[model samples]
Target: MRLIKRLLPAFSMAVASAAYPVEWSGNLAVEVRTFPSTAQWPEQKDNGLSLSFQPELRHRWNDGDQAFTFIPFVRVDSMDEERTHADIRELKYLHVADGWEVRAGIDKVFWGVTESQHLVDIVNQTDLIENIDGEDKLGQPMVRVTRVLEDGAIDLFLLPWFRERTFPGAEGRLRTPLVVDTDQARYESDAEQKHLDYALRWNQTIGAVDAALSWFDGTARDPELLPGTKGSESILIPYYPQLRQAGLEFQYTGEAWLWKLEAVHRDTEQEDYRAAVGGFEYTFVGIHDTPLDLGVLSEYHYDSRRLAANSPLQDDLFIGTRLTFNDTQSSEVLAGGIFDLDHAGKSFRVEASRRIGQSYKLSLEGQLFSDIASHDPLAAFAADDFIRIELTRYF
Candidate 1:
């Protein structure tokens, strides 16, 4: 309790700082979602509403060579208690010198190319409580150094602490039968959460080809699910193990087509496996004399741990389409589906967004699970299809 009280004020610098004045900007939003039907699980509802606020604060000096950033975010939900949360998206200090840079504190980094999934992105842990698809990430504290080269940049990272993945509460939909106890989970390392991690990445762009090579060692950000029996009940526990991983991400941007690839090989205490996803996108502009653009995407996924996987995408095909209105409001839409080649399963999603008036924006997204077999892990959530709408105000 004392440690937390001490750290809270450090992160609350926007209110306490008098020496370095802070400037703030961000968004406030409200969302409504409908599930249409009851979930297969209990304590779940059909409709829900949530409100979120995020404020970004920054202080800079030294002619922009140095700066400090802080982004505090929070959300409240009417139905799902698990969805209500708060987080610091960024709390970092950055310094740039000639051909070199240094960053220390909490930050977020992203890597990968495909639209459906990100295989080579492992710098930050996923904030699963915010979204199930692992698209949102928690801030990770670390020290990073970058060296600029003639044709590429090399980055080095020293991570001293680890963050646990958030899970949905018992009342949350799309959760497992037994709630996962993240605090009571086990670790294979003797250092437990004290284990330090390290990583290196080299990125370069040669003509139209942009690519990167990365390697990571130490504690794994992902945890394995383990089931245990209580007195008269059962529970699921997460187990994290030390690991080493090597990854590659590349994309070729052309006039009308883009090719993307991501591959990773992981060596863990319990398993050694590899996974890859590759795809391409082609766009047609000014279709049929209109100001509309259409894009088609196709991708394939493969895993060495096939059949032992919990996802339906172990060996699957993904096809999607993108639509751009090219209007004043800058409206765009995307529709996609993934099909399991070996099994009878499919998943579909649609997302669209547009700016309203001058300061408001509206977005809609939905997902559907269909044709799932009993053997598929997602079969239980077949009735969990839902659509969500959000309206945001920016100042």
Candidate 2:
């Protein structure tokens, strides 16, 4: 709330003198999920429903040299208290000059090019309650300066505040047996969330290839789940440590092939490790003499931590296919699976979406977990096969 209050006045002041009109756009969505298997925990539910709204407002003045943007998001869930929350997705002011640009306030920055996992994306905190894939993020407060060149750019960041990662409540499905107690969170820095962090990146595009190198020094976004006791019940406590990370992102674009790689080497007080994800995607345009295009994707994930890694993507192979129908409705379907090489675990997902009429869209998704070994990190959710349906209205 303090952040919102601070940014709103700044935004009004930045664009008050200009007579340009503000543009408004966003979406309202309702989502439903059903679990076929029984709940793993006694407090969990078999079905869940949520409603979310995100509205964006943008204003540009001084002939596109200056701009202000505000985006707010909120979600209400029927089953999980932690899932029902509100956030400022973006609230930033931008100033463009001859060869540089400056952005200030809370915003989101993404820095990876992978379909299965994002290894180099660390600017924003993960909104874990929204999804298990870690695609959603909470906005970060920063002041950024970018120096543009003929073929490359350099970005420098000054981050003032850190947002903690969200976790599923005890009543939420797809959670561990013991709930996470967020109130007991601990940090290595004396200032905790107020610790100042900084980062820099250099991005360049040379012909058919795009590459970026980045470095960050800050409190780690992902926390270590340490065992603790909340009253009489055992729970997990989040412990954040200071970290330094170096990341690289590479992509090659061709007529029919796309190659991507994201790698990171991170160091902390406790440990240091390297992880990477590399893949190639090939597209078959106008397959079978039709207007449909099919793309095949293959990726490999590797981590030095192996079994000691935090997530389940260590030493795994991912294969996926995307089908796009070049029609008026803009229909698409994506199916993918990850196979664990060491534990014989498999995770599969399918997603399909199509526009309805002019203002509405419908999407369906299914997740299947099978053949998980007992030693695998994802073995706890072996019985949690679920499907999701979503309806979104754009305005």
Candidate 3:
């Protein structure tokens, strides 16, 4: 505790000095949500409301010959309960030179194509949905360097890692029981476990199109279940092992339209599973002067080594729009559906939100799952849905 207290002041001083050349700017946002159980899943009902608020700060640094770059970020989020604990959201330091750039600290690293379904969402933030199901990965300490060439740039990054558990639902929301014994029960903190991650990427621009390719490899400690477990013969605890993944992405950002595509392949020897995902997104802007933004996102996923291994494909679709009202406020509406193209079930979601100001917002989001055919064993569960309303203020 004494050491932490000593480090805090030094950290703050460094950050303050780093912002010496810039002005201060920030924004705040808040949200709330609620869930109600349906006939299909009567046991799960009246999930309480979740509220969250995030405040951001940004500083602009001036370096001659280089453009004025601003690093905008969220400082922290305050939640209502243990499920909604405060966590570090973003902390980035950037330096731009002639043809070289360096960025260090924690920030969102977007490396995929799907607008709604992200196969590589390593950074976690607080939102209506995220507040319910916590993020799968914690903030990773990293340093990145980029060098620009004639038409592209080469990038390299090193990440000092951490491991996180994937909850059944949103962070603060109630969770369903584990249907399989293979599910992890808790995180392990043994000394023998190793955790480290490294990545390399290249981004190039051709005429009016841009493309990026990245490879990531990491090792984590995971736990496995022993024999004599309840539902199944065994379960897996959070032990440690190696995890590897590679991904490629492409995008075309035109004057009024944007197109994106991405694919990822992941392998985990510990879990004895291999998975792949492919997705695409397109957005058109400025319709009738209302800033109408329309987007469609789709994802195809396949997994090897599961109880029902034969059925390995799942797909989802998301259609959404954003309407900006004036300069400080906006409204957004989205509809999504998930289908087991190879099975007999579907899940649908509808979400809407209104930004009242920089510090406050209102929203409504819900999801429903239906079993269409003979109720695939995986689809035996009934439809589950919820409604949420929240008010937030940021510091």
Candidate 4:
């Protein structure tokens, strides 16, 4: 797979090698997180902290009417036992013309309307509560081609794949009926896996409003079995089966107000699970002469799945607002709740963030789980309370 991925960029470049002037730019970002013991979740009694830093670099050259660009990035997490350990998050080369473009590399792809949804987030940091052993993997390698029409664009990609293999931990043993596997499993071959992604987007202006529509299909693998699960032989777990998604967004700029709305749909198939998600987000901005700007955002998400005879539907709603001061400092508040429409379980979350300076920001997030619903499985491991704090700096 490595050889194939490397050959693709060379081949594409060879097809159109026009000399171009090169330009370079890059940015660095660091994030630190710390958690304190809270009585809300007894299982999370230990205090922990982690730090991560990522640097990005890019070069672009324009020759005549064509352009070539390359971007490569690396990330290091201080929590890693090997202080210098790193992961290649992005390494892509691109060729562009008036209406055609091609790219190849390990890159990040995004396909959703919400910042926190599983369907739309790419280049993500694993949730602190979800990291099995705090292992961070590299981005997927792929080749993509895009065509820019007069008012719209279409793209297709070929992806290289990898899988996660995990051991059964205590939590897995008590919840899942599957037997435990102690030996670590290996990928059949980094060279033979087949993965692909395709996307299309269209944008147009209607009167005073701008609108966009997008579609996506991509592949992803599941994380290793949950800690403490009883699973011995590692089997392929498809996080999403030929995932399909579509999004529509509209924006209206007004003299004293701005309005935006976005909607998305995602469908997935994995093992014995078939799920679909529909989500929407709306934002309202009140423009004033004062230095402060006031805005509100509301979103709704629904996840429907066929797990077992006794499973319940998963649905959630999120409402939030933002207050910006002096154009440089801001505060945001968000509330989200998940409930089983057919059963009796529910979960709620409250999160807040504040920007300290042009380069620094801080955030606190917390979640609560209660009311046992259906026995659909995944919920068994849900904790009563989960909390985390984050500080980030951009350079």
Among these predicted structures, which one has the highest TM-score? Answer: 2
lDDT of 1 at 380: 58
For model 2, residues 33-55, the per-residue Cα lDDT tens digits are 89899887888888889999999
The superposed Cα distance between candidate 1 and the true structure at residue 131, in angstroms, equals 1.5
**TM-score of candidate 4 to 2 decimals:** 0.62
What's the TM-score of every candidate structure?
0.92, 0.95, 0.68, 0.62
lDDT winner: 2
lDDT of 4 by residue, 105-157 (tens): 76656543343344333322332222321233345577777778665566665
Q: Which ranking of candidates, highest TM-score first?
A: 2, 1, 3, 4
The clash number for model 1 is 0
Q: Which lDDT values do the candidates have, in the order given? A: 0.87, 0.93, 0.53, 0.49
Total clashing pairs for each candidate: 0, 0, 24, 9
Q: What global local distance difference test value does model 4 have? A: 0.49
Which should have the higher TM-score, number 2 or number 3? Answer: 2
Clashes of 3: 24
How well is each residue in 48-161 modelled by candidate 1, as lDDT tens digits? 899999889888777678899998889998877878988888999999999999999999999889988888889899998777678999888899999998888999999888
lDDT of 3 at 128: 27
Residue 159 shift from truth in candidate 2, angstroms: 1.1
List of clashing residue pairs for candidate 1? none
